[model samples]
Target: MAEKAKVYFTDFRCPSWRENLPQKLARLMMTAGFGDIEMEGKYVAVKMHFGEPGNLAFLRHNWARVVVDLVKSQGGKPFLTDCNTLYVGGRKNALDHIESAYLNGFNPYATGCHILIGDGLKGTDEVEVPVEGGEYVTAAKIGRAIMDADVFVSLTHFKGHEQAGMGGCLKNIGMGCGSRAGKMEMHSAGKPYVKEKKCVGCHACAKICAHGAPVIENGKCAIDQNKCVGCGRCLGVCPKDAIEAANDEAPDILNKKIAEYTKAVVAGRPCFHVSLVQDISPNCDCHGENDAPIAPDIGMFASFDPVALDQACADAVAAQKPLPGSVLFDKDSGCDCGRDDLLYANHPDTDWKVCVEHGEKIGIGTRQYELVKI
Candidate 1:
């Protein structure tokens, strides 16, 4: 069998044809062997990060519009989706999540689609998918709307991530699709504790804690270790910086869990992936604001294999030279001789290979791919 090839089209030399984006993407899909009716009449869930309110650099609605139109032209009914956040601010509830999506220019007529919060109200509506992976033990929780979709497409804004090395297709689907409690499970392997110095007895944590494990004792709210289940609910709501996750130096474990969660989200679905290498923020778009991009707008990639798509996207981005006046303006950090320009320039400590390798090991997709340019 031939190796799967990832389709690539750069942001360069594509400005004049901006209005033809829908037809362009449709033609690309045709070349990839997808018919218009294949997407037509299907519940095409276009999974994407609408981005936090304060974050400026995110996937544009024009791109999503192109995708929605293509799905429609092919007879697919498309709807934009993202799960409720684990954080305490905006998008924690369905109403606020919808409002955030609207504020981000994803209104019904704008993107030629409707927006739905993947996990229902309060971030609790989810179905647990059973997987026999040794590390995952019981199962992983995924958003029901995503689970029920006839077809799925993860359109990710690829960028640097502090914890996962990079946020590509796998991170976009795994961590992106997880409900709040599911996210709690992924991050809960380590226990959370209260820092006495930062604990101001604000009682926010106490209010959100379901078990009442945190009680005001001696003028300070304290977490009863015995009663605490490490659910992480209190940690997210804690106004004071008292509650924090324990040291988790095991990145490999975290990567594996992310992969398993991604599996749960896309299990048995005809899924596709697209990663845009523009405005590559250092932290996730979950943050309120995005720092300058480390590189110029690179390109867009598409593939049937999420893992290979991500790996290919990373390789393409890492081959580019860093743009001056961006986050990685300095060139002499530590390039001994011939190093990967993008990786070495943007972040010297991170290794993106881990995400692709782990993803491949779990049968997410093969790293081998051909670069078919559109």
Candidate 2:
């Protein structure tokens, strides 16, 4: 297939890309036909995740400032936003979610825009929109903020994922758009029991359990498997890490959910994507604590096609030698300097390819692409 996405990789290592990323991204949008947006005075939602507090590997606000300014220059009102998380963490509610964004330097003062949590105060605020995916029918419960936007642009931090292999355009749009309940669906596909010894109870997990799986018996949350819906929501809400997304079918189900959500986000809106390949962490930034990066800082990529952008970004990452201090370099390195670990040699257990293939099959974009370096 011909290349449908154009991914430009830039990094802090090269001061030019860092200094010029904003301008580059701005022009990229126009060059890629964002300027042709038919509606005037349209609201352009810049979908971005403000990394959970304590996680330092988030996309820089400076980059966002440039993009937002450019959008305004083009007469598009741009706002940076993300939906509340299903887990009972820093971002479970709008208040906590906004606080986390502010803590992460996304305050309105910094980015010249508002940081609106997709779901409102309780995370139950949603606007269901119809889509043609199997798992979903009537509509996806999208954050009202995201559904209200006239157009969508995803600014993603590309990195390794503990569940879906890697987080990229599709993950950003799909999982990111989900309201707390939407998140419930994606995570609920599998259920893992809590180890009795690991359970400090604390009732944290029990509180978020939509089902009465966890009950506080003598000040400890005891999960009743029969009542549990397998939402996996309780697992992440537990501060002690007692609950976990079981290895059952969570991975595949999560991927499918991600694709369906992406389709929902861009159903009618003209959407564009930019995936930063730098600081390729071994796990998603969803972690309260970000581990050391697994891959060295690569570059930035922008594309209208989520699939091609992901494929190009993956190819670029595979082509580089692991950084000396990073986790990937610590593993035995036999792959070519210019070829990434496509088979995930370092991570024999995880496979990032499934999402790309599934996305292609579902028509998210094309895995077949021509890499264009600018």
Candidate 3:
């Protein structure tokens, strides 16, 4: 049997004389062996989500300052990063993405580090990395900037996810690091298509595609499926936001792909992970608006093994009772309020275990863990 990975945990309790939560988080990270990494003069990519415009559940910049300060203390050059979103939102492109991040209070002044959108201006700048033991994706399209970093660190906000059951470390790293095309590949088996009503025949997509996928006719645009390569460049340049990817991939396969993409990211790097199990929202922070939290704040977690960290977090969430007014407790008369698996009870169709199981199968990390309290 594989040895259990050590996961460090610290609750959000502080007296007037005690250290603050951020300082305690820094201590938790050090206890998890974050200080052991050789970080002198290396570029460290701190991967995290800059919440959507109106989402209040996302991690505050104060939490990121802890990681940034620690990295700087070790002489590591750190920068915050997250790839552009596949969906049409505040974070689809670099400029708008930065604006949204700033709008959500993740500016350099707040986080004590610069923000780099992993993909370039249009979400097309990517590096095709070969997934060593991948079953679904052979070559995962990761963001160029994220892959360029010498060290990777994930700062995740552990929460309930509608599609993947829970958005933990793996979700934050795998789905977060993938380029637009990578996201499309994981979410859909089919290529992108142009919506006729939204298409203005701007010919921007036609000009950008080397394959001549976008064809203009009758002052409207249509994508030729045979010629399209699914690079996802058209989605960024569409003035009318007409081009859209097909979300046809099954939930299980999507979870597997997320695991595969995560393998492509942290396979050969010095990686560390930290998760704050607070504001356990029902949906992703990608939503423009955030609903009430499903559970009360549990605490913070840190680990060298992301898989173990995620497993520990899932376990912690499972131990909590549902918040009365949240969706988990009010899902109708058939709601399983007493269910031990809160994540599954919240989203019955999604199984969060699939991602971790696939992650372990792909040789990233094991799900078994020993929680060490600080």
Candidate 4:
């Protein structure tokens, strides 16, 4: 029926250790058509998540150097980039974000490129890019620096997500590229609220909130939804971990929105996606800590179509045996039998397929892919 997209793959087998994993990744990307793009003197955004401070599941800085060196060889002006997080964490502002990246070893000396916090300091600098044929977001508030890039490349850490089920290429490009406001828009249908028990009467939330959404009374703060613009700044500034997102949106809708956001990021640009399906962690890299991997390490995958790349990765993970002591192995062994969908089996509340289906339906990419092992 439809033409299948080509997804290049490579196992983690390094015959002599001289070639190394980074070299293998570079070779895989080239095989997947990375060199086909005209990159001479063009601004290329290498989007990826710099693992949160203590998380060890993110792609190493050495892996990033390989991509950076490749882009430089092609005369592309490449920069490592990612927008601020929506949740309260170590990466809400550019300063803290860079610190976190450096803490996680994403420094220039390590990655062979400078890091650019896409949304600027305070995560307020953004460009509203129109999403063509979008059912959810008409205009996505993307980081100005990301939108300024002539080419977009996603270097994703393919792992499990509590919400998206699996954070693959689509999740990396879509949700990872969104600005603070954009992330807020995709995350929940309503504003955040303060938990009374967790609130310490600290005016920290009130101090950070521009709209005065957090009003303190009797040492307890309440968020006024009418006044709150859902910027998600308070969530990060709260010292007591009192503020939390409503998370009111349906999982399917959230997945579709992620696809729409991804379309916005890569729509008019030359885009390439690379996913390292290793570390097979049971949660997103955004977490401060990572649990043991759910499955054994798969390998690297690269594709022009993120949807195709993600599908190929999903298939690869499905073919693997779950790690005996990991979360998947311990979670209801009954369902694990004959269940190919380990991601869903790990988190039954979320359906990872929704994102890819919406991606295909929205012309992001095709799910049918030819997995070409390099």
Q: Please give each candidate's TM-score.
A: 0.85, 0.82, 0.98, 0.92
lDDT tens string, model 1, 194-300?
A: 78887888888888888878988776777787888765667556665577656454556666778888877776868877778888876788888898887667767
Error of 2 at 126 (Å): 2.2
TM-score, cand. 4 vs. native: 0.92
Give the Å shift of residue 347 in candidate 4.
Answer: 0.9
Better of 2 and 3 by lDDT: 3
**Ranking of predictions according to lDDT:** 3, 4, 1, 2
Of 1 and 2, the candidate ranking higher by lDDT: 1
Off by over 4 Å in 4: 196-221, 233-243, 332-339
In candidate 4, position 24 carries an lDDT of 91
Instruction: State the lDDT at 293 in candidate 3.
Output: 89
The per-model lDDT (C-alpha) reads: 0.75, 0.73, 0.91, 0.89
lDDT tens digits, residues 1-374, model 4?
88999999899999895898888999998888899999999999999999999899999998889999999999999999999987778897889999999999999988888999998887778899999889999998899999999999999999889999899999998898888788888988888888899999889888988888889999899998889988777876677778887878888899999999999999977999999999999899999999999888888999999999999998787666668889777764524544667887777888899999999999999999998998
lDDT of 1: 0.75
Model 3 bad stretches (over 4 Å): 332-339
Candidate 4, position 70, lDDT = 92
Worst lDDT run of 10 residues, candidate 1, spans: 329-338
Clashing pairs in 4: 88-236
